[model samples]
Target: MTREASPAQRTRALIIDAAADLLAASASGEFSTREVCDAAGVTAPTLYHHFGDKDGLLREVAADRFSRYLTRKQALETTGDPVEDFRRGWDMHVEFGVANPALYNIMYGRRIEGRTTPADHAHAVLVTMMRDLERAGRLRMPTGTAADMVASAAVGVTLHLIRTRAAADDHLSALVRDAVTAAVISPPTVPGAASVTPQLARAAAQLEAEMPHGSVGTLRASEATLLREWLTQLSVLGRMAGGAPS
Candidate 1:
């Protein structure tokens, strides 16, 4: 069985669609509430009643579009290698930004306080990928630190491409991606590897990922907690001292 949208929902969708069309056609990425009301054929009070304010309307617009972008990313097939998947994710992010300059700016360029944006959801996906790399002994830094580095660099590169209109510069995106990837990923470990520090760091990371949250076997819950902290510290220290090159 199919359920139809209420009149209110249809009106809200109409407004959002109108705003999105205007935003895409806008050169400066700026629009007035009056313009939106005109485009949607809605009264000012009706617009305000639905969205509260212009900023609220804009936030909803950005969230709606960015959520669609995330849906495509989520549907992508993983390449088994988390590193490769991460590279693909980075490229996709830049592609999305270049393709939707106005919407991308709204999504990432400004802060929308007291709300969860799709950008935050995208970062969480990156963090989860970093953790996967950590568990595989491929990551060199703390998962959170690595995620932050990649997210910051990717966003910066995307914004630069958007502003400079150099969206076709694949070399520029690749150069930055490779640089950041090299900084955070370790070379594949060989059996009986000679580098002790990297090996130790990988061991610590793997153990940390596998560590039980509560008591297991002879270990108490408190002991497991303490051991997890120590492993994390060891991993961080080892990476700080320099791990294998990517």
Candidate 2:
């Protein structure tokens, strides 16, 4: 069954939509509280009462816009090749930024703290992709480290395109993506080197590194404790099998 929005929710939605429209049409990629209130047919007091201030309202708008972009990316089918998946994710991120420069800038261009948003989910997805690569013995570095490199490069490229408003070269995103991927990934191993034990250990270590820092929405606290234990066991087994230090 579909639930209805309450009055407060409806008002909030109206304000966000109005602000989003203003932001999209804005030449400077910014909007004012008075502008939002006028568009939403509400007073300044109402806007402040609901959103605390202009920054708060814009933050919500950025989160909402980024969430929409994420929905589209999440809908794409995973082909099970983690490297290819990561490439595609990078491309999709660039596409979203180019399509919505104002909103993308709001979400990522400025540095801020203490804002809860779906941007974290996008990052979590990247970490999981790196973990998948680890499971296949394809990751050359730690999962978190690789994820950070990918994100930093991707954001830089996307923001550059947004700033210049250039006719984006299709090769630009792919070239940067390949460069970053190459730096962080190992080539395919021969049959013997492709043993499952070490791959398992690598994957566990990757997940362990991520679980503490990012959103592990799939596991509860107790469940994560048990999973960590199992991961440790797998890692130890892998080390024992390969006589390699982790």
Q: What's the TM-score of every candidate structure?
A: 0.75, 0.74
Please give, for residues 80-194, the per-residue lDDT of candidate 1 as tens digits: 8766877788888899999989988988998776477778988888898889889888786799999999999999999999989986356889988877776677655444434
lDDT of each: 0.81, 0.78
Clashing pairs in 1: none
Query: Candidate 2, clashing residue pairs?
Result: none
lDDT of 1: 0.81
Best prediction by lDDT: 1
**lDDT score, candidate 2, position 227:** 63
Off by over 4 Å in 2: 190-246
Model 1 spans > 4 angstroms off: 191-246
- RMSD to the true structure for each prediction, in A, is 11.5, 11.3
Q: For candidate 2, which ten residues in a row score worst on lDDT?
A: 187-196
TM-score leader = 1
**Candidate 2 TM-score, true structure as reference:** 0.74
